[model samples]
Target: MSKHKKAAPQQRQEMSGVERLGLRVSSMINHPIAQTQRWVVIHRLDTDGEAEWEEVIGLLAETPELDLTFNDDGAVTVRWERSALQERDDFIIDEDNEVETEVAAPF
Candidate 1:
């Protein structure tokens, strides 16, 4: 049998403006739903030299069932159904407080 080894982890690529923004927003909540409708927590760096958390809700193109609420304080909360099959598998999306702080901070 031929021997095979696992490949090393690749370095993260530099994010574009939109990606940066998305990444920032994704790191400030807990248990974000993935593309498969599974909940996952997103982690990222913050301005205060700390880690932050966030959540993301995956949405299907054919089925549209997501809503967003934005507060005056720059905070956002999103509510959406987890799966089309479930009667009530909704989730809330919150702002990545850490990322927001990071973006606002003077680099």
Candidate 2:
């Protein structure tokens, strides 16, 4: 008889503290509100997350999709721009079928 083993090593695996902090950082920077509260994000990173500062910097630098931008106001924000998310001139249903869109812009 064969020995029984765990079904999945990664199934429902708990994230490490670093992973959790990374998630929080991602959410804060990616949120629409972050654009207006850039300083708040920086302040939190400086004070609350000071210990993990190096890890945070590594995450931002190592991530090819994430970009660190320094604003004129002295606040920094991270942004990710997926190539697939770029604006298309018209609506697309499928590879062969595209529907022209009438933009609501008055200009």
Candidate 3:
């Protein structure tokens, strides 16, 4: 009889503290309010000091999607071009579709 060997279960990689922070920052910046204003201010929280926040901002700024400005009051202002978001097809509104949906009023 041949001996059967069981395969070990694979473990999934988890987000690091810094990565988690980055995700939160990204989400806040991508929110409708923030995206509409084209800017968002991120203040340092009690859990993270200026240095720590700076590190997180640095990591999150690695992408070309955001523009970061470090403030003297330990805040970082992030901005992105509307065009950057508009490049995505979903962001584009189809005016033609809206016109088509407008039905003539009944007499």
Top model number, TM-score: 3
* Candidate 1 runs further than 4 Å off: 1-13, 26-63, 85-107
What is each predicted model's overall lDDT from 0 to 1?
A: 0.37, 0.47, 0.64
For model 2, residues 7-71, the per-residue Cα lDDT tens digits are: 76666878765676667665555444432322123323434355565576666667665577656
Candidate 1 vs. true structure, TM-score? 0.32
List TM-score per model, in order.
Answer: 0.32, 0.39, 0.56
Candidate 2 scores a C-alpha RMSD against the true structure in Å of 10.5
Clashing pairs in 1: 27-53, 28-53, 28-54, 28-96, 29-53, 29-54, 32-40
Tens-digit lDDT track for model 1 on 17-87? 44564555444323332323322223233431211222232222223554545547534444444443244
Candidates arranged by TM-score, highest first = 3, 2, 1
Report the candidate with higher lDDT, 1 versus 2.
2
Candidate scoring better on TM-score of 1 and 2:
2
Q: What TM-score does candidate 3 reach?
A: 0.56
Candidate 3 residue 87 Cα shift, in angstroms, is 3.4
